[model samples]
Target: MEFKNVSVVKEANVYFDGKVTSRTVVFESGEKKTLGFMLEGDYKFNTDAEETMEILGGDMSVQLPGESEYTLYKKGESYVVPANASFEMTVDKYVDYCCSYKK
Candidate 1:
């Protein structure tokens, strides 16, 4: 998505293995999101609020809480995670993603 003339605050310096990292972007409407890239690995994340994660590039296998199977999410696909819930992700390569938080 193209954001025209938007003000962004903060940068996400999250590093799972010091190789995977992300940058934070805040919108003017008070919503926040992160643009990140992940290497091949498994990751666990906890959310404080509801989140919609969009896969921008590459591929990943995701396992949400209570789900028995891992779902595949590729480029242009998205998934929603409930507030206070955690999710697991397995990246097979360098996956680019955008994670937006909802109020």
Candidate 2:
């Protein structure tokens, strides 16, 4: 039982090591743009509205702009991407736990 790949929810033969992971966004927070990210790496984006992402698995770091500071997130960890937060980070095997609006 893993949420990594929904395609074969019950099979464990193929290397599900991010072999194929996707999301079906059924309902979004119409108020702002939302997205689900997976893999190992930081995302670069500048938005008028704040974006949120949850660290479902793997190690990751959050680096905010204008500061030489960073926040670290581990497995089962969650954090919010502040509005106007021009930040960049490196994700070490990071997967996103996003809107459960799936098929």
Candidate 3:
């Protein structure tokens, strides 16, 4: 993967007291994605749009909205979060991820 004629946001979107941060990238066609890193911690997040998050490095345990169990996702694994729902993430080690927002 290569992106042509795209813009990268200089500032990162920081969350969880700087435990998680991501850089925004906008494609020429107007699609957007974020490349991020998360430190060891647990986080709760809510979404306005459906999102697909792919683990790129390390490991993650996620509990999606309405779920009672935490599922482990290693590198190269992906999970979907529905719009208007919230999820819980437990990161035991530093992790890298790519998050793509759906239309």
Candidate 4:
């Protein structure tokens, strides 16, 4: 997938001591997205807006809110996170992903 006519922020959103990083992309239609990658590690993310995370490459095991087990998602797969909720992810090696926010 690709985005056209979008503005990308130079400054990255760095997390977990830079284990996870992303750049914000603003579209002409006022939609926002972040393209990033995760290194081998476990992570937990909290969202203010609802988010759809698509795996671009590699894979991850995710535990959504209130879920006890992590579900594996490979490249080309996606998952949704509810607003004001949180999710956990386990990346074996690396994962390339795009996250779109719905406000």
lDDT of 4 by residue, 12-73 (tens): 99999998999999999899999999999999999999999999999999999989999999
lDDT by residue (46-98, candidate 1, tens digit) is 98999999999999999998898899999999999999999998998778989
Those runs of model 3 whose alpha carbons end farther than 4 Å from true positions after fitting are none
Which stretches of model 2 miss by more than 4 angstroms? 1-35, 99-103
The TM-scores, one per candidate, come to 0.90, 0.52, 0.94, 0.96
Candidate 3 per-residue lDDT over residues 4-50, each given as its tens digit = 68899999999988999999989877888899999999998899889
Model 2 lDDT vs. the true structure? 0.51
Candidates 1 and 2 compared: the better one by lDDT is: 1
lDDT of 2 at 17: 60
The regions of model 4 sitting more than 4 angstroms off are: none
Q: What is candidate 2's TM-score against the reference? A: 0.52
Give all candidate RMSDs, comma-separated: 1.5, 7.9, 1.1, 0.8
Candidate lDDT values, in order: 0.86, 0.51, 0.92, 0.96
Q: What are the per-model numbers of colliding residue pairs?
A: 1, 0, 0, 0
Point to the candidate with the largest lDDT. 4
